[model samples]
Target: MNNRIKKIENNVQDKNSAAWKKLCDYIDRVAEDGSEEFSPANELGYELFSQIYTLPETISKLKKVKKVSLYGSKLKRIPPEIGQMESLENFVPYTSYSLHWFPYEITECKNLKDSTVSTRALYGNYKNRMSFPDLSQNPVRYSGETVNCSVCRKKMTYDETNQLWISLWVGTDVLPLLANICSEHCKNALPKPPENYIQKAHKGSSTLPQPPDENESFELQIKEYEREQNTINNP
Candidate 1:
């Protein structure tokens, strides 16, 4: 396997390991006081967790944490268990380059108020416009590889799922996240993307709206400025 896939597999293994459980126990104790700050990169050694692609599902154990930082971790995904962090308010995952998306379940945190992300690395980012993975078709099941529904977490075969992609502002950045759902019920449970985005789940392809070229974007900005000037003068 390539280094990228290897890192992801390693992260998955770490999530299930005893060491990860120990880490979770530490965080859980700190979370109860709601005063201590947590920076996994610093506590765990940046070089160690930086290669991790996903956080453990034990993240839900931080029920009283008010803020969490995950700066510079090379994460590819976050577990939906994060939605269970009832006291979470601030989320920082700045510079996590490989994390292209987030789980829609994050909206379950009613107290979550702010977030920071590396927008440039995101799929379909406004400035970069990187294309998202083509998710209209279900991913093929590899022999012995397990596939689970993103929402329900139930074991499923590739043929038993439907794939959808949506972009939403989970905290402060709009992230393009993918969901492999087992049924339409789970798909409907997704919250809407932030206002002024594509406004619907879509398959990744050239058909999606393209960002304007530099010249075109500049001209559009000039026209917008002129229109605003006219409105100000007349009003």
Candidate 2:
């Protein structure tokens, strides 16, 4: 498994760019045609990465698209508007190594059931605990032009926002989600993460205590067994 953290390209989406226009048009078509699946790479070609680093917020318009296939993309991030894809069910973005955490709003996709993500490349995968981008110092980095309380959905400014990462069940995958909140009350009320994952929301830090991987756990078990054998031999 390639466990090393990739240097994520934080290139902001330029709506005026050709790639943005192309993606917007695609979403418009899907919205009008009511397509069940929407695959940008197939429609835009393998070179789609060269044109865009992230999807357009206009993706919210794809009300009928149940499946989104972004296999093997170079996308750095997905827009918060993805939460508005009310019909989204199967999200397949496997091999998108640079794509790390997802927006907390993704939980709003009530119909989402199945997903295929690059687990090792994810921020808090059980197999590879990659560090999250620290949001304490700069919360706006994860938020959009407007900040809002992830829990209560109340509008707030970036100054009033408190960003934290929480790994919760999103479409059959425990994805590390970025939450920008307005108050401690909201933070306290956030849902508990799954077992063997970080139990609380936290700013991204390499020192954070996460569950050990299988290999590390196995090594510890071996050490314990060896110590027990040594004690028996000495006795």
Winner by TM-score: 2
Candidate 1: regions farther than 4 A off: 1-36, 136-159, 185-189, 210-216, 223-235
TM-score of 2: 0.88
* lDDT of the structure predicted as candidate 1: 0.68
Best by lDDT: 2
| Backbone clashes in model 1, listed as residue pairs | none
Whole-model Cα lDDT of every candidate shown, in order: 0.68, 0.81
lDDT score for candidate 2 against the true structure? 0.81
lDDT of 2 at 187: 94
C-alpha RMSD values across all candidates: 6.2, 2.7
Q: After superposition, how far is residue 62 of candidate 2 from its true place, in Å?
A: 1.4
